[model samples]
Target: MNTPLNLAALVLALSAALTSAPALAHGEAHAGAQAQEVVKEQKPWGIAGDADQVDRTIEVSMTDQMRFIPDRIEVKLGETIRFVHRNQGRVLHEFVLGTKQDLDEHAAMMVKFPGMEHDEPYMAHVGPGKREEIVWTFNRAGEFDFACLIAGHYQAGMVGKISVSPTN
Candidate 1:
């Protein structure tokens, strides 16, 4: 017979199944035991860019102080940019691009699930003294955010801004 407890358990099971796969894959990748392919999905800010279409290259630094050097960046809509990430700290850092709300939600998830992992075209997981890159095409004209959502990093203020202006 159907009951409230069963419904609650069903909801909980569904949520865990939907969310845990990516986190599990991320954990494996984080441990350097496997490689996860870049997930391709169109986002409000833009989509995964073709390396051959990159119009510019921007270098960003992730420091131990929870800061991204040159925290603000401006780009023209429709331009493809190759962002090079340099991790200068002794710990691991991430560069995740998304809307402010999306980032805030993800940050909260990170706080609750410290091992949460996600790999996409707009994110880069960089280890200390390591270098990584994200090629993105800013097809939308608006403001977006990039942050390091690793447990206390986001709460400690590890974030940056990207302003995309219309091309016309």
Candidate 2:
């Protein structure tokens, strides 16, 4: 029944969560710090959105199989979206929004620095049985990507797509 594979996956998940323990311990302050660090750079995806400005909310779920339900999503340019992520599996997961290149670069970084802590308006890290939300405005018209860059998760194909329709 692939017990060894299952055990390996569990170990990876626990390790991922443990690595973020220090940042999580400080609550939102550390999260805020991470978000600020990311914000200092130009966002290749979209800008952070105000909660009151969200045009709609999308519900997404993550599983231990390394997948996001409804992996493809569409939105209009200039529209703000609130992503509601639920971690239904017995592992840690994160929702990070970016362009394909942005995601790829970040994935590579995750492999090098698994315990690296940083956040942005477009990222939400969730532990098992928990939920998190991120609001973002799709100011540009292009295809973006979302992924879980937790150690082996991204390599296991835990990713999603976002399409922003062009506006005149």
Candidate 3:
């Protein structure tokens, strides 16, 4: 009698344990699905890059109010960037990538050009509703600043930061 009772108790415990396994797995699967949905929604405005690619592309649009839609950018060291800049502003605009010191130096040089130097590879003075593009590579990891060289533009918060991380 004692032996039969002990066997029955063991069987019951094993069955309960087996039933709970599926429930735990189902809960994990549900959580994973929710995380995937969030990633898909935020991907368009997010910075994406491939370490193996020769050039990574970033699209930036400028408005008359002096703002970049995505004000921050991220990249890995040794990655090349292809920047597509569009001017949706009433006045001219530019997208220049360099250090704070480099921007200051170049900004001074821009004054030498009459009105604004609208035609340069690293600089652009695109008029309203116009678009321009530039490709550059980052050989090292550091904080880089980008801005419009037009007078009073940088002072009006037309600046942004780029973060580069160490390559894997």
Alpha-carbon lDDT, every model: 0.85, 0.82, 0.64
Candidate 1 residues 1-168, lDDT tens each?
769989999999999998776344442343332254555688999998888999999999999999999799999999999999999999989898999999999889888877765556777888899888888999999999999988889999999999999987
Tens-digit per-residue lDDT, 1-168, candidate 3: 699999999999999998875432211232223223212111111232233454667889998788886779998876777777877777777787767887888677655653531332344445677776555566667788888767667768888888988888
Q: What lDDT is obtained when candidate 1 is compared to the true structure?
A: 0.85
Order the numbered candidates by TM-score, best leading. 1, 2, 3
CA shift of 24, model 3, Å:
68
Q: In candidate 1, which residue ranges exceed 4 Å CA deviation? A: 1-37
Error of model 2, residue 2, in angstroms? 57
Off by over 4 Å in 2: 1-42
Error of 2 at 32 (Å): 5.7
Error of 1 at 63 (Å): 0.3
lDDT of 2 by residue, 1-168 (tens): 899999999999999998876453211332454344335334767788877888999999999999999899999999989889998999888888887888898889888888775666778888888888887888888888999988889999999999999876
Candidate whose lDDT is highest: 1
Query: What ranges in model 3 sit over 4 Å off?
Result: 1-54, 108-120
Per-candidate Cα RMSD to the true structure, in Å, reads 8.6, 11.1, 21.7
TM-score for each prediction? Answer: 0.79, 0.77, 0.61
C-alpha displacement of 118 in model 3, angstroms?
8.2
